[model samples]
Target: MLIAPWFTITVLAGIMIAALLAIQRSGQSRYDSLVTELEQTRVALAQTKATCEERSEKKELEITVINASLNREIAERMQTEAHAKKLRKQFELILNSAGEGILGLDTDGNFIFVNTAAALMVGYEPTELIGRSHHELIHHSKPDGSPLHTGECLIQQAYRDGVVHSSSTDVFWTKDGASFPVEYVSTPITENGDIRGAVVVFRDLSAFEP
Candidate 1:
């Protein structure tokens, strides 16, 4: 039998060892790829959670802003109502203290409100005149003694014209059957340039009545 050379045996052993090292390196490369993929998935999940949280916070802030706006509107409405009530009380005090007769009527000529002195002048209790019509209360007449509708009444005329005037031809009859000639001034009350009502102040002219 021929003997194998030592040099050939050494070369063959070196080739086998190199092949084994290449196989080990391939296994380690596969493990490294799996680790990189897991890390990327974790980063994606964290970004998604952060985005959801940001959206939720924005919605909460919007709700807070809306609630604040509604609160301000409610406060403004309450203040307006309070101011109107105060003005009405002050007006009533002045009306009751005045020596002259005063009256207020709505747009439809219905008595919406009145004062104590006005009731005393007409010979009725203040509560009794709250809903009464002017035609029911006033005995409107001409110099020639004619029944009158308020359409032709002088106080109404001044209200329509938005003019203030004083007159002596006016007369008001008390509930006690006493008729009085009167000198009076009538003025229109307007809001936003629209006629709301009129105020009439008067005194009896019985001393000079013929």
Candidate 2:
């Protein structure tokens, strides 16, 4: 059998048209898949950025709290120091204004503080008596001109026993090697129920005598 020329041409055109349509449909499907994947990626990136911002905000808040606490502690310490200094000045003024001779000794019987009246009565400057052994400076001898032992001194006893002692016949030697009668009371200074030192208050008996 022989085919006609028109029929052969028609068959070739139909095959070409079908091939073109299949190619266009395949390209459209691929494009739709790519768009769906890109949308999913964008949503994941947005969630990650939000989580990072929240963590950064939380860390910043913690740092601010820590700084505030440190600042408060520093301010409280400064205030406490200032109050202590003011109290020390008040104590110094009171000691200078006292009429009786006052002496403060350390645990080792060394002079730690001597008021103005005490220094004047002993004929020495306040600076001269500080850090010196109290027994060596003025309490070395008795009223009868006998050598006094440290073990027998009442001031030393006060420091050891945490007691108060009073004497009306004791003598304290002056800086110029002279002696004067003194009536003194020695009392222990205590902290936390422990004896730390002694404080001596003395009056010149010569002033009371005619």
Candidate 3:
């Protein structure tokens, strides 16, 4: 059977149009899928950025806390040192203002400190008496010019017994080798039932004698 030429041409054009429509639909579907994937990737990146920001904030907070603690500790230590220095200055003022001779000793009978009166009584400066042996400097002899042993000294006895010893008959020698009568009280310094040293307070009795 012979078909019409115009009819065949119209049928071929219709098939070509359908094929082009199908390709356009397939490209549209592929573009939609790509858009969805891009949206998911963007959401994942935002979450990761938020997590990194949170961790950075936490680290900054930790550093701030540590710095604050260190600053507080340093301030407290400086305050303590200032308080201790003030106390030491007050102690020195009191000792220098005292009338009676004051001598401080360590456990081994070494002179740790001496007040102004003590240095004047011995005819020496306060610095000269520091670190000197107490027994050798002023307590070396008895009133009768006899040798006084360390064991027989009343001050030594006070250290051993951890008690106060007072004697009006004791004698202390001066730097010029002159002897004078002294009334001294030796009291042991103790801490927690342990004797550390002695404090000797003395006055010259020559002025008081009638």
Candidate 4:
């Protein structure tokens, strides 16, 4: 009934070798799976980096285009303003050099512009006449020292009727309260067929009078 010693030793050695082989196979399989997962993670990171880089480049391009457009608009606006300023200076020079007394009035009969000849004839500085009421300053009374009503003023009527009023018998008062006859033409200023105000061109009749 007893087993041989050599057989028992050979069987025990075979079992140990089988167990060690099984463990090595399992460890190799797990190592392969870990390597695969690491590769996938690296690929995902590279894709994310590429997407971010593309978005940054697109945003930078948009910003550059916007800045260029803004710069162009600013340059155009400055050029337009410079041209307007030049035109305004030329207009002022022309008005000042005119021989006739010329003045501009607003819708309410206030003086908006008074040229050199107009200011001198009215005995006022150009600045002093501007913003002052035209009727109150120069056309407030008749030649006989009677108050002239605003409703009866021909200059006011010209703009109200959108017509030209010419008169040689009108009287305009000076700063010293002296009345002088004036030959004047009141023309309405119209824009888009709408009357805005009036411009008065006048000549002093003092030298011609007796």
**Whose lDDT is greatest here?**
2
Minimal lDDT window, size 10, model 1: 1-10
Q: TM-scores of the models, in the given order?
A: 0.57, 0.62, 0.61, 0.62
Which pairs of residues collide in candidate 1? none
Pairwise lDDT winner, candidates 1 and 2: 2
| Local distance difference test scores for all models | 0.57, 0.70, 0.68, 0.69
Q: Give the alpha carbon lDDT tens digit for every residue of 1-210 in model 1.
A: 112332232223223222333434454465555555555555555555566877556555544554454455446545654655565666566556655566665454555555575677778886777767665676456544566777777677655877765678767777876667777665565555666555566666775557
Error of 3 at 103 (Å): 0.9
- Compared with the true structure, what per-residue lDDT tens digits does model 3 show for residues 148-183? 999889888777898777788989988889888998
TM-score, candidate 2, is 0.62
Off by over 4 Å in 4: 1-81
Model 2 regions lying over 4 Å from their true place: 1-82
RMSD of 1: 42.7
Q: Name the TM-score of candidate 1.
A: 0.57
Q: Give the CA lDDT, 0 to 100, for residue 19 in model 2.
A: 35
> How many clashing residue pairs, candidate 4?
0
Rank all candidate structures by their lDDT, best first, as comma-separated numbers: 2, 4, 3, 1
Model 4 alpha-carbon miss at residue 55, Å = 21
Local accuracy of candidate 2 as per-residue lDDT tens digits, 1-210: 112432332233223322333344454555555555555554555555567877556555544564564556456555654654565456556666766777777778988667788899999998999889999999999988899999989989988998878788899999998899988777776655766677777778888889
Taking all chains together, the TM-score of candidate 3 against the true structure is 0.61
